[model samples]
Target: MAETGLIQSRYRLIELIGRGGMGEVWRALDESLGRQVAVKRLKPVGPQHDRTFTRVLRERFRREARVAASLQHRGVTVVHDFGEDEGVPYLVMELLDGQNLSQLLEENEQHPLPVEHVVDIAEQVADALGYTHRQGIVHRDLKPANIMRLTDGTVKICDFGIARLGHDIGMSSRLTTTGLAMGTPHYMSPEQISGKEVDHRSDLYSLGCVLYEIATGAPPFDQEDAWAVLVGHRDTPPEPLRTHRAELPGFFDRVVLDLLAKAPDERPADAGDLRRRIVLGRTGEQPALGPGPLARPATGLPPAPRAKALPAWTRSMTAGRPATGSTPPPAGRPDPAAGLTGQWTAATATAPRTGSSVPAGPPAPDLLATLEGRHGAGIDLGRLGRWAEAAEVHREVAAERLRLLGPDHPDTLATRYEVAYTLGRLGRWAEALEIYQDVARARAAVLGADHPDTFVARYEAGISLGRLGRDTEALEVYRSLVEDRTRTAGEADPETLRARHGLGVSLGRLGRWEEALAEAREVCALREHTLGPDHPDTVISRREVAAGLGWLGRWREALVAYRQVAEARTRTLGPGHPQTLAAREDEAHCLERLAQA
Candidate 1:
């Protein structure tokens, strides 16, 4: 350790900053750039003659360098350089002058954060996390020690990609079983503890744990031993954030608790949604949250990177490969949303954004978003039912846009709604429901309940709920959505037409076949008027009308309507497409019912 003064004839090591299982951090200088840097000198491994340790450690170090160097975000600490300085592996990063969350907690034990402050920090971390998760990377080890609160009040995440590399290379042997293989028990996700194939949701759970601690200065699941903590994570729910800070908004508690859901299916669909809710809670007229000062963006910090602009592994901690079973199988190898794409959105310039003439020029710094909000525009090659690819792409773009542009900004929430619709088609109903709910809340928060986007997300949410088998619940949601859409989307708009169909399905599920038939006929008539009788959606809606008529015991009318749908679909989409085949099947069934009648 004595010989670790400086390296590269630059980055002069001034003093030891901190130490962890892997190594010690040193305040250093970048002689080339005349900037301050933090260098982590990893603890060395076994005997040089031990080829096994040496070979493994070297590979791990290289992978870490690649991962850290690749990560460039305002919330993430920047890795300037990494090299073997005289046989000791060293990684140089931006020197953030700040105290860690651990230190802050130690100073103020059990003292709850101001609601606004807790939300601000959570929003920033969620944004960075969303980006990292999308890159297919999970922190695997998120805790207070890894998060630093900069002098200017900004939170900077550190040692992101290094935990895996550092643990594998040599740190595990030194720290014992309590260190490398398992994470800080208080923050470990259940899947991570069980060593199951984890996903981005695992990271969200871990982050929720972190937020739990920050909100109340106590770990969500506290037990005497690491094993107990693991069990608590698997079984227990954290005390609601409001319990600790009763002044906290009820919505904030719901958001945090949702993140801590035992199953990922129950959590908010992604980190982007988390951020949106935070924004609304903090800034809304009747803020679901409290009075926290809005964050200033021009502070000294690097700009966020454009989301979906990085290499795959940048967010691939959970990706494991180009495929995740979370969504249906995609079409090709390079999926845009393959990684931790929807973890957090990149922060746009968040300065007082009320005036119609928005601020121009380069965006302000110190914002916590990872994506720069540049959405990709390109045509994908056709693939056989590659619904996953389209769904993922729309989800990624929509999440980023919402975070970058806000709910009513036209692009962000709008794009997200498209992704939800795609998820329904791709069979990811649970996730789609979550996404649609988020969009709905954001729309209701920003634009009021009657806004078009509000109805859009609510309508989609009702559709997802219907597919998920909570039909009675779906009926209520769809009924409200149908009314809302009729008023906002108008009877002829495609979305309104779609919701009308949802209403009929919900009614059938509730055994109100007469009402179902009437609504279906109305939607079909409206669609036919607006889209021409032969249009695909119109023909599909018409088929639904026939199905409703059959349910209502009007078999002869059902057969007639079904025949028209089958012919129209067979003409436009040929005989093999799913919709076309479905229409034909419906027509045949209706004919049989008619003969019986």
Candidate 2:
């Protein structure tokens, strides 16, 4: 529940403007500054809720404030202040006089926006993205609803809730532990759909989706089913824009299509390049073509990168219904305008009522929503490193889901998967191994042997085997997983290289020094090429190369590798960071070994 008046004794809430699942936005008067502002207040989590979930939510709210407040661009929404009122977090921002693109579409009856308006919005967004990317920020969740058009035609990008700072890999990884892709299904890049590392290029792909929708009155993939939409993004080449709207400029169509390339490398090199191309196209100059749809022979463009499997988590995702003025709310629901900004309605009516009896059949939708929230709370606890508490909550959720959804249900198996991961974190290797194997089998049966989720479980099973000192078994698991990953995701894919790295480690554990060295070198080179030389995964592979060199009695070469890892870690993670210190320790040991020789 939100209060109606003054908060923090400084800002006065005047009227409710927007509401979302997590918070509500109010048109407020900043008494101290004598100005009007939009104040977004987080919905308070009751004491009955998991304390860990409540804490994580507060942290995320604070992060969004910090990230948004740090930016000072005209094409981005400006943050004024942030504070907590009565234990509820709130953020204050500049209020715009016009609606977001989603609302504009709804107002226009879902017709395509004017072509010139579309081009103007694209250029403004590209310029903003260029600034943000240069500042090392990647907006992971970019959609039409998150971009706004002011009354004066100024365009701004909003919502930094899931944005990732380039230097904060550990924080980013922890925040995403809830097993959900951060972006909307229609806008997700192929790499994002397949659970691969995403960079700024992912934002470009999402912008392409936004541009396509505004230009053609629908998303590039307009499928009703969420799975179908995700598959379309992963495998299908979008129909040319001219196919839907004949009046769209050829150069503009080519630009949007190029941004939608399946491979990040095939897209423009950066937002700066994208902006330049847009500028060139607007001025009647031809932009240089790359390997995108525009570079094709005009007969057809190459198909999207074909992955043999999609992540299983996508199966449970919903196709986010686009907002439309024609569709009225059902009886007893609030007006759509009440929930304008977040593009999602509150879950109040969807959760099971307290003190109510559940029927003894299939679980009710309300009960399922409750279970899902609790499951997410469990994940949040794990993200905070409370493994014992996380394990307890996950076990409880897994049992409930199993009873209601059956052993083969994806939800039940997903909960069970979390339970196993927590057990491994708690050092219960044998128990974790058993659960991992079971989940892998169940997922394989349901989602096929080649599904990414099944492969994820199998990969963890290998880690558990290794932790239990069953090196031979771990080696076998990694070898099979590497082959499958290579066949499905391609050899250069990050996941495939990860499996190969595991195989190399297992070989070293079995004292196969020569084979481990070769495998390590190859995987290290590939990781460097695919993930960048200083990425954490590439650094890990480089460390493995050093370990292989040392095991092969190449002390001088090992020393060089160890020193390189140490220097890279120091540069990226800072000299005082634990990982950098560990790298330094490795270098010292290498020197000691060389001295003894």
- Winning model by TM-score: 2
Please identify model 1 stretches exceeding 4 Å from their true place.
1-4, 46-50, 162-182, 284-597
In every candidate, how many clashes are there?
Answer: 25, 0
Against the unseen true structure, what C-alpha lDDT does each candidate score?
0.59, 0.73
lDDT by residue (tens digit), candidate 2, 89-124: 999999889989999999989999999999999999
Clashing pairs in 2: none
Models 1 onward score TM values of 0.45, 0.52
TM-score of decoy 2:
0.52
